[model samples]
Target: MSIRAIIADDESLMRSGLRLLLGAADDIEIIAEAAHGAEAIDLARELGPDLILMDIRMPVMNGLEATRTLMAQASHPEVLILTAFGTDEFVYQALRSGAAGYILKDTPPDELIHAVRAAANGTRTLSPSAVESLLGRGTTSATGLAGGGDGGAGPLGAGNPHTPDPLEPLTAREREIAEAVAQGMTNAQVARSLFVSTATVKTHLARIFYKLDVSTRVQLALLVNERR
Candidate 1:
């Protein structure tokens, strides 16, 4: 089945360009377009597209707010943030808002299509610059983005050995899976690398999420990065 998608952007030109580019993909379908976040949300409710290509800045509501609202729904389309901003703050906020993926507007068309597909498949995709921002190479530390309260010690309590490690509950295999996921490997890629089936990888991921008390792959990646 083709991946049904909606393009949400204030700029008509940008939306048209995206529609043209994504429409060319054999497996992707542009079902609708929204001028702002509010329209996007309403269309999502009505259309139930598989994914949404969202812009960060909009008139009525920004993409971050829209993403948060949509993700809070019991059933909602996957949100993939497409913006010109690759700053640490934007990347952190986008991930924190439950975006399935973040890519710069300048990204190659091929990679953008791949990101949309990966996101629809429940993979956490990020542009290389976004990954760098998440890795503490940017102005905002990874620990902060990971919801770390005390100084640099994240939710996993990295700096305090006295505090029990959050990842301790994971088994050897589970830890391996978590590590691969933190490296941004998709389920299929992780399965291929570990000589396991995609189903097995998914099973391990569920356990990893439960063991680590994380709901999203971005959270899992932050915890694993903090450990290193």
Candidate 2:
């Protein structure tokens, strides 16, 4: 099945570049292009593409606001945020606002295509460079490793011998389910892994979502990964 897509960016050149890159792929179809966020929003509402590649900074409206508006609808397509700089911190805002994926503007052509396909399929995607960029911001909240809390040096092990944080505390079973989720296992897959019924896994996930204060699996992954 071909994945219909809308490419949105402020620069015509970037849109053209995407057209050339993704248009060549066999499974993707570029249904529309928008030069600004407002136009992107209108086109998205009209075309109802499977995915949108959105640039964060644009005239008339920014990608972040546009994504929020687009995703407010009942059948919103996934939005994959794009940024000019790999180190840009706007990705966090996009993810928090319900964006499905994120990639830097300068990402390799092949990876961009893959990211788009992943977003279209309801899978979460993030450039590791983007994650490193956010970590480089020097926010104390990034590692939570500074001082009297646990004396842990960082997420990676150190000689400090400190206990890791539980971003969302879970019971043994909940932790097992969460690990399966982190591994990209669907509910059925999780059930098979745990030798439990799919209904049971769904029940656990509902409770986990509430306990973690996250609305979606993407948010759950982000919050849980941050803890580790």
Candidate 3:
């Protein structure tokens, strides 16, 4: 079946260009397009697309907020964040926004198509530029994930209380949702970003909270940031 998708970007020309490119692919289908985050959320809820190509910057609401709200729902879709900024903060924030992947706005057409397919098939794809940022550009940086300070480690294999637990237990989607909530996305925003309903993001949050033994969004955010 063709992968149904929505393009959520504030730029009309960009959206139109993407639509044209994806339209030629037999395995993909453009179900909708939105010029802003709010419209993207509304249209996704209405169309029920399988994937969303979300732009990080937009009017009315940003992609991060939208992704957060979308992921809070009960039946959210996969989100692939696209942004012009490849800064560490932006890339990290996007990953934490429940996006299945992150890609630069200037990504090659073929790679973007591959990312859509990957997201639809339950695989996460990070833009090469974003990955480079995550790994740090040069040596002499902190080696541990999310850094080792601030009690950032979870109870991982080392039996150390500070070590982060193995992330293998959680589904990719759940992990993504947890990360997004950690980045401070609202349920509505997650729902829109993931192309799912608000109730779905809430369900995911409940499960994540239980697993993390946290009671509120604030606690969850702290935990994820500490152990991310």
Cα RMSD to the true fold for all candidates: 6.3, 7.1, 10.7
Assess each prediction's global lDDT (C-alpha) against the native.
0.80, 0.74, 0.71
Task: Give the per-residue lDDT digits (tens) of candidate 1, residues 76-167.
Answer: 89899999999878887888678888899999999999999988876667787786776654322433332211123223323555655668
Off by over 4 Å in 2: 137-189, 198-215, 225-228
Q: Which candidate is the best by lDDT?
A: 1
Task: State candidate 1's TM-score.
Answer: 0.74
What is the model-wide C-alpha lDDT for candidate 1?
0.80
State the number of backbone clashes in model 2. Answer: 0
TM-score: which is higher, 1 or 3?
1
**Best TM-score among the predictions, by candidate number:** 1
Residue 146, candidate 2: C-alpha displacement in angstroms: 25
TM-score of 2: 0.73
* lDDT (Cα, tens digit) per residue for candidate 3, span 90-177: 7667656667777887888998888888777644566666656755632111222221112222322223367766444567888887
lDDT of 3: 0.71
